[model samples]
Target: MSGPHAPAQREHGPLPFALPRVTATQRRRAAALLAALEAHYPDAHCELEYRNPHELLVATILSAQATDVGVNKATPALFAAFPTPADYAASSPEQIEAYIRSIGLFRNKARAIHAAMKDIAEKFGGRVPRTMDELLTLRGVARKTANVVLGNAFGINVGFVVDTHVERLAKRFGLAPADATVAMTERWLMALFPRDRWCDVSHMLIWHGRRACKARLPACADHPVCRGFGSTCELRISARASDTDRTKSNQKPGSASRAAKRR
Candidate 1:
């Protein structure tokens, strides 16, 4: 048994499967893939609902520990009650907290939103800043939220966003190595896809993660992009089987088996 152990490998260069340095051919493939995904999800956009940057900032804050659906439920009343940055700047934390009580960590989000609004109103003339540096100045506005607003709202693609779904799919798609951090993942994705497609890529990848490449179980059997990635497809196929078992348990006894046969 002691003979079964082997020496660890070492390297100062790329990971064994680090997405081959983006060649012109690879870029072309990426472009075609992007085109297909864009066509498939033409309507894909930021899930957070907001009429303006200020609302987007607030909604993104609310979305920290809550789903976009839940945040959407909370924002209509919040946006109506405080229609302007100045309104949020002047409002008490108690007022903002009341509107967003349904979201987790409302108290902290209330504090961040109130402070950020005051800063925006006083320093930026009651508007959310379009540039990365200025946007980063707002409380709770990190690269993820800033990228979201700048890309979707202002059409400025400073960099790619690395959200939970993006992170998961990035790994599952073999776009980045297993140990990739958010910043590293962003760099990897930006390198692979074209600059203009960065924002849309996040949306498409997120949609895929939600509908197919889920965290717990990915539906690789039906995912068109599975094989292009690599061994992750194997992981997804297994996860898909696990999903089938759970699904079968919830359905009429023979229904799932029948469906499998038909497929």
Candidate 2:
């Protein structure tokens, strides 16, 4: 789980662009990393709860720019009202909007969901399309949603799903370069990890990213892989440790002793 590349030895002693070839050893280490993460996040299933493919698709449509918890909150009633693609297609945009208005961009999402459902019911016989090409034919179904549904619901990993957390974590962990675009990042990840691990890895990384390694202030000191990558993370860990020491020194003697014992 060391850095993907090593520093180059030059006139200045070491330059940063000396990328190592992808050896079998490195691949094995990467595989170990995958295994470790899988062990830690075993229950890392899709947070968007759904009974079937259609429900998953609808939930995913509602999940854009919105938290999964919020989407889940609104989905019970929404799913009850429009239990199928045909049900959503039959309803008006106004009716859908009224239910999911708490979510961001509800008005447009209502329209997209309704339009997508109409397309699905008419063109695909009321079942969510199974292939990437077919899924893309829906109005709001981009690569992200298509990948989620295809991978989780249909056992297909046609493409990597690069969401915001994935993009941030990929850059931070040196899985991809800092400047890599989402499409490029996805390609890099797919190439690095095995295809069969894609679905589980995506969810696990996302869960880890949100819970342990946040964008603003990742708990890198507590992260097992934090030492494997990132100059920023190293500094963050050092600073966090220093801050903890300072806070401990300021605490009452008994409390400080308890904290020290806990540490």
Which RMSD values do the candidates have, in order?
13.2, 11.6
TM-score (all chains, Cα) for each model = 0.79, 0.79
Candidate 2 weakest lDDT stretch, 10 residues: 1-10
Off by over 4 Å in 1: 1-21, 231-233, 236-263
Residue 90 Cα positional deviation in candidate 1, in Å, after optimal superposition: 0.4
Give the whole-model CA lDDT for all candidates, comma-separated: 0.78, 0.77
User: Which residue runs of candidate 2 sit more than 4 Å off their true CA positions?
Assistant: 1-26, 228-232, 235-263
**Candidate 1, residues 1-263: lDDT per residue as tens digits?**
01012112111223223433677866776677677677667766777878777887888888886899999899899999999999999998888999999999999999999999999999999989978888899998898988877776666777787899889877866678889998888888888886666887888888877777677656766666654554375675678999988876789978878998999
For candidate 1, list the clashing residue pairs, or say none: none
